[model samples]
Target chain A: MAAAALREQLNALLSSMFASGLVDDQFQQLQMLQDDGGTPGFVAEVVTLFCDDADRIISELAALLEQPVVDFDKVDAYVHQLKGSSASVGAQKVKFTCMQFRQLCQDKNRDGCIMALAVVRNEFYDLRNKFQNMLQLEQQIQAQQ
Target chain B: MAGAASAAAERKVTIRVLLVEDEEIHRVLARALMKAVGGVELDEAGNGAEAVRRVREGGAYDLILADRQMPVMDGHEATRQIRALGVTTPIVGLSSDSLAADVDAFIKAGADDFTPKPLSKEKLNHILAKFNLA
Candidate 1:
C-alpha cells in the first residue's frame, strides 16, 4: 500500500502547481503517460528536454538583443518557439511570458525584451525547482514502496 | 509500519480511477496522488474521445476524474458520449475554473461530481467519498 504521507506530499505539490498557474492540462498528459507504464522518469525526461530547449532559446534571444541592430524577426522566432513548447508542456506562466515577449519583440523595444527576459528566467527557475522537487518526492515514494 | 500495514490490508479496496486530462503534468500528479491514496488503479485518456474509448473497451470504472477542456473532444462531450454508451462510471469534472455554470454544464453533460484544479487532498477525498470510493 502507498503511504498516506507520500500521497499528501504529492497532493500538496499538485495543489501549488495549480494555484501558481505553473501547470495546466499538459501536466495531466504526463500523468496519463505514467499510467501507461511510462515511468516518472519519462516525465523527468520530457521536462528536462523542455528546460534545455528553453535555456538554448533564451541564450539565442539574448544574443539577438545584444546586436547593434536587433533583428526583431529573429528574436520573434525564438519567442515563438519558446511559446509553443511552453504551451505544449502546459507551462502557462512561461507561455504567457513568452507571448508578452513576442509582443515586445514586434514593437522593437529592447528594454521590453530585457525586462521580459528577467521574467522568463525567473519563471524558468521556479518551474525547474518545482519539477525537481516533485521528482524527488516521487523518488522518495518509490523508495518507501 | 506493521500496524499500518495491517490496518491498510483490512480496509484494502482497489479504486478504479478514470483519469480525464489533456496535460502531462496534471496527469503525473494525479497518478501520484491516486497511488499514494492506495487501492487505486488508474485508466487514462488524453481527451474525451480517448477516455470514452478506454471506458468502452475496458469496461466500467469506479470513478472518472476528467478535465473541463481538451482537444479533439472536451470533457463535456466525453461525459455525454460515455453516458450515451450506457456506461455509468461516476465522473467528477476537474477544472481550474470550476464555475457554478461550468459545474452545472458538466453535470448536465453527465458528470457526477466536480473538483477544481490544483487538486487538494480534501477536495479529491470528498469527491471520492461522495461516490463511495474513498
Candidate 2:
C-alpha cells in the first residue's frame, strides 16, 4: 500500500513538471529509451548529460561575450548549439532566448547577446532547480520502498 | 463508511510515466498536474536521443508523452526508434498542431495516442483514461 502511494506521489510530481514547462519532448524521448536491454537509469543519465551540456554551453557563451572584441561568429556558433540543446530538451523559453541571442550575434550587438544570456541563464536555473526537486522526490520515494 | 471504502477503492495503481517535451513552461506545468493526480511515477528527457537513452537504461514505463518537433531528434524518429528497440510501453504524441493529418502521422510513427496542446487538465485526464493509466 505504501509503495502504491509513493508511486502516485511520483506521478503527480511528473504531471506538475509538464504543467510547469521545466521539461519538454526530449524528456519524452527518455521514456522511450527504456525499451532496450542493458540500459537502466536512462532518464537520470540523460538528464545529467543535459545538465552538463547546458552548463558548458552557458560558460562558453559567457566567455565569448566577455571578450574585448566580441567574436560574433563564435558567439553565434555557441548560441546555435545552445538553441539546439534547449530545443531538444523542450526548454522552450531558453531556446527562444537563444534564438534572440543568435539574432543579436548576427547583428553584432554584444549588449543584446549579453542581455539574452541573462534570460537563458534564468531559464536554465529554473529548470535545474525543478529537476533537482524531482530527483530528490524520487530518492525519497525509493528509500521508502 | 461505504463511501470512504469506495473512494479508497477508486484509487488506481501507480503508472510509470515518461514525459518528453521541448518547452520548459509546459514541462513544469505538466509535472505539477501529474503530482496532483497522485498515482504516477514520472521521468523526463529533453530530446529523442536522450529519451531513447533513458528508456534503454530504465525499465519499461507505463506511459510516454512526447512532443512532435525537436532539434537533436524529432518525435516521429524517436517513436520509430523506440518501436524498433522493441519497447512496448504505450506512447502518446503531443503537439500544438490541431490537424487530424498530424495526429495520424503520430499514430503511424508508433504512438498509441495523440494529444494536442495547450494541454488542459481535462484533456490530460481524458488521455490517461483512454490509456487506462488514470
Candidate 3:
C-alpha cells in the first residue's frame, strides 16, 4: 500500500478505536509528544514499553493470585503499576479494569479480586494487540516516507 | 549554606532544577522536558532520600520535581523532610496517582504543585511561570 493510503488507514483505525472506547485522549497526547526534534516514534516506543510492562505484570499477577494464600498487598502493588502504565499510554479500558481490581485488592476479597484480575489481564492483551497494530502501521508509514 | 546558594544563584543565568525520580526513563523524560524550556541547569536524584540529602547540602535550586512514589522514602515524606531542613525551594510532585486525597497528601506534606505524567509542556511551563521559575 502507498504512504498516503497507509496513513489514511491508520487514521481511520485510530478514530474507530477511540470511538469504540479502546483508547482515549491520552493516546492522542502521546502522538503529540512524538515529534522530539529530529527524533520520531516516541509514542510507539513508550507504548511498546507499556506493552512489555503489562505482559510481565500479567504473568506475575497470575502466579501470585494462583497461590492458596494470596498476598493482597502484592496484588495491589502489581495492579497499581498496571494502572499507572495504562494511564500513561491512555489505555483507558485497561486502566479502568485496574482501578476496579485495585479496589478489590483493598477490600481483601480474594474471589472478587481473582475475577477482576482475569478481566484486567484480558484488557491488557486486547490493548497490547491494538497498540502493536498501530505501531506496525506507524513503521510502514515512516518507511514509505 | 544559604550564602553559598545565594552566590551560586547570582553567578548563573540559568535556572537550576533538582529532578527526583527513581525510574531512569522518567528521569530522561524530565531532563528532556527541562531542555525544551531552555535556560535550565538540571540535576537529578534517584529517589526521595537522595533528594533530601541534596537539599541538605544546599545549592540554589529554583525548583524540585520529585516522583511522589519511590522506594526508601516517598515524595511526601521527602517534602516534609526537606521543609524540616529549612530548604524553602519550591517542590512539585511528579504524581501518577492524581486522586484528590493523594494530591492532598502531597500538599499537606509541603509540595507546592504537581504535574502528572506523561509530562506536558503546557502544564509544566504554567507551573514554572506561576513560581517565577520561567
Candidate 4:
C-alpha cells in the first residue's frame, strides 16, 4: 500500500483508540517525544517493554493468588507495578483495571482479586493486540521511506 | 509544539539529572523526554539506595527525579537519606499516586517538590524552571 494511505489508516486507528479510551494523551506525549529525536522508535520500544512487564506481573499475580494463603501485600505490589507500567505507556484500560485490582488486594478480598485479575488480563490482551497493529503500520510506513 | 521545542532549545544549559526509577522502560522514556528538551545529561539509579549512594559519592547532579515507589528503597527514604548526607540538590518526587498524603510525605522527606508520574515535556521544563536549571 502507499505510504500516505497507510499513514491515514494509522491515524484513524489511533483516533479510534483515543475515542474508545484504549489510550490517552500520554501515548501521544510519548510519540511526540520520539519525534524529537534520539530514539527513533521510542514509543514502540516502551510498548514492547510494557507488554513483557505486564506478562510477568500478571503471571506473578495469578500464581500468588493461587497459593493456599494468598499474600495480599505481594498481590498489591504486583498490581501497583502493572498500573505504573500501564500508565507509562498510556494503556488506559489496563491501568484502570489494575487500579480496581489493587483495591481488591487492599481489601484482602481473595474472590474479588481473582475476578479482577481475570478482567485485567483481558484488558491487557486487548490493548496488546491494538498496539501490535499500530506497530505493524509503523513498520510499513518506515519501509515505504 | 514548535514553540515549546524552540523554547527548550533556547535554554541552552546542559542540566545534569539523576533519574531514579526501578523500571527500565521509564528510564528509557525519561531519556527521550530529556533529549527532546535538548540540553540534559541524565544518569540512572534503579532505586532509592542507589540514588543515595550516587549523591554521596558526589554525582554533581543539577537535579534528582526520584520515583516514589521502588522495591529496594522508596523515594521518601532515599530523599531523607540523600538529605542526611548533606547533598542539597533539588529532589523532585515522581509518582503515579497523586494522593495528597504521598506528596506531603515526599516533601517531609526533603524533596523540593512532587510531580505526577509519566513526565511530559512541559512538566520536565517546569521542574527545570522551578529549580533554576532552565
Candidate 5:
C-alpha cells in the first residue's frame, strides 16, 4: 500500500476504535508520547506486554475457576490485575469486563465469574486483533517511507 | 522549580526521578513522560522494597513515583518506610485504582500526591509543578 493510503487507513481504524469505546484516552496519550519520544515501536512494545499480561491473568483465572472449590480472593486478585493491565493499555471493554468480573468474584458467584471470563477473553482477543492490524499498517507505512 | 535543598536558582541540571513499578510497560510510559518534561534523569525499581533500599542507600532523586500494587511490599509501605528514615523527598503514588480510600491511604502513608497509572505528560507535569520538581 502507498504511504498515504496506509496512513489514511490507520486513521480510520483508530477513529473507529475510539468511536466504539474500544480504547480510551490512555492509548492516545501513549501515541502522543511515542511521537515525542522518537522511539521505534514504542506503542507496539506496550501492546505486546499488555497482551502477554492479559494472557497470563486470563489463564490463571480459568485455572482457579476450574477448581472444585473456587477461591474468591484469588479470583478477585487476578481480576484486579487484569483490570489494571487493561486500564494501562486503554482496553476499555476489557477493563470494564474485568471490573464486572471482580464484582462477581466478590459475590462468590462461580457461574457469573465464568461468564465474565468468557466475555473479557473475547474482548482481549478482539483488541489484540485490532492492535495487530494497526501495527501491520504502521509497518507498511514505514516501509513505504 | 528547584529542589529546596539546591542553592542555585537555575535549573537543577537534571530532575532526578525514581520510578517504582512492577509493570515494565508502565516504566516505559514513565520514561516517555519524563522525556517530555526534558532534562530528567530516571532510575527504576521493580518493587517497593527495592525503592526503599535505593532511597536508604542515598539515591538523591528529586521525586519518587510509586506504584500502589506489586508482588512484595507495596507503595504505601515503601512510602511509610522512606518517611520513617526522615527522607523529605516528594513521593507520588501511582495506581490504576483511583478509589478515594486508596488515595487517602497512600497520603497517610506519606505520599505527597497520587497519579493514576499510564501516566500522561500533562499529569506528570502537574505533579512536577506541584512539588516544585519541574
Candidate 6:
C-alpha cells in the first residue's frame, strides 16, 4: 500500500479494533506517547515487550498448570502480570480474558483454569498478530516517506 | 499579576529529575513529559540498583521516577536504599500494580508517591506540582 493508504489502513484497523473491543484506551494512550516524537517506534517497542513477555509467560503457565497439584497462587501471580502487560499495551481482549483466568485460578478450579488458558492464548495471539501487522504497515509507510 | 510574574521570572528556577526504568520507552515518555512541561533536566538509570548508586553519589535531583519492578532490584528496595543513604529527594514509583497494598508497599519502602503504569503526563505533572517543581 502507498504511505497514505497504509496510514488509512492503520487508522481503520485501530478504530475497528476498538469498536470490536479487541483493544481499549490503554492502546490509545500508547499511540499518544508515540506521537510525542521523543521516541520513534515507541508503540512497536512496547508491542515487542508485550509479545516476548507473553510468549514466555504462556509457556511457563503451560508447565505450571501441568503439575498434578496446581498452585493457584503461582498461577494467579502469572495471570496478574500478564493482565498488567496486556493492559499496558491496550490488549483489551487479552486483559479481559486474563481477568477471567485469574478468577478461575482463585477458585482453584483446575479444569476452569485450563479452559481459561486456551481463551487467553487465543486472545494474545490474535492481538499480537494484529499489532505486528500494524507495525509492519507503519514501517512500510516510514520507508516510503 | 505583574509583580508575581516578575518575581517568578527573577528566580529562573530549573527542575532536575531522575528517571529510573528498565524500559527505554518509559524513559522516553518521562523525558518528553519533562520537556513539554519545560525547564526540567532529566537523568536516567537502567534499574533500581543503578538508581540507588546514582543517588548515593549525590546530585540535586528534585524528583526521581522509579519503576516498581526491575531486574537488578525492585523499586521498593531501591527506595529504601536511597533513603538509607540519606538522600531526601522525592521518589515516586511507577508500577502496573496500583492495588492499595502495592501502593502501601512502595510508601513503606520510602517512595513519596505511587503512580500506575504506563505513566502519563498528567500524573507526572501532578507529582511535579505537588513538589513545587512545576
In order, what lDDT does every prediction score?
0.77, 0.73, 0.79, 0.90, 0.87, 0.81
Name the regions of candidate 1 deviating beyond 4 angstroms.
A1-122, A125-145, B1-10
C-alpha RMSD (angstroms) for model 1: 10.1
Q: Report the lDDT tens digits of candidate 1 across residue range B18-57.
A: 8888766567566655654556778888999998888888
The most accurate candidate by TM-score is: 4
Candidate 4: residue A139 Cα off by (Å): 1.2
Between candidates 5 and 6, the one scoring higher on lDDT is 5
Fraction of true contacts kept, per model?
0.00, 0.00, 0.09, 0.59, 0.59, 0.12
Error of 5 at A124 (Å): 0.7
lDDT of 3: 0.79
Tell me the tens digit of each residue's lDDT in model 1 across A1-145.
3667877988899889988899987676656545554354767766776788888988998888888999998888678667756764678899889878988988999999989988998998899898888878878888888
Give lDDT tens digits, candidate 3, residues A4-101.
99999889989977997878887776565555433376676677778888888889988998999999999888887777777777888998998889
Error of 4 at A15 (Å): 1.6
> Which DockQ-derived CAPRI band holds candidate 3?
incorrect
Residues A1-145 of candidate 4 have per-residue lDDT tens digits of: 9999999999999999999999999998888777757468888899999999999999999999999999999999889889889999999999999888888888999999999999999988988888999999999999999
In angstroms, the error of model 4 at A39 is: 3.5
Question: Per-residue lDDT tens digits of candidate 2, residues B92-118?
Answer: 998755479989999999999897764
lDDT winner between candidates 3 and 5: 5
Pairs in steric clash, model 6: none
Q: How far is B58's C-alpha from truth in model 5 (Å)?
A: 1.2
Query: Tens digits of per-residue lDDT for model 5 on B97-127?
Result: 7889989999999999998766887888788
Evaluate model 1: give its lDDT: 0.77
Residue B5, candidate 6: Cα error in Å is 19
> lDDT tens digits, residues A1-145, model 6?
6888899998898888899898888777667755754457777878887898798889889999999999888888788778767877778899889888988998999999999999999988888888888888888889998
- Alpha carbon lDDT at A64, candidate 6: 91
Best by lDDT: 4
Worst 10 residues of 5 chain A by lDDT: A31-40
Q: Give per-residue CA lDDT, model 6, range B15-127, as digits (tens).
A: 78888887654565566556545566789889889988888877678899888767789888999999998888999988776889999999999998888876666776688
Q: Report DockQ per prediction, comma-separated.
A: 0.03, 0.03, 0.21, 0.58, 0.48, 0.22
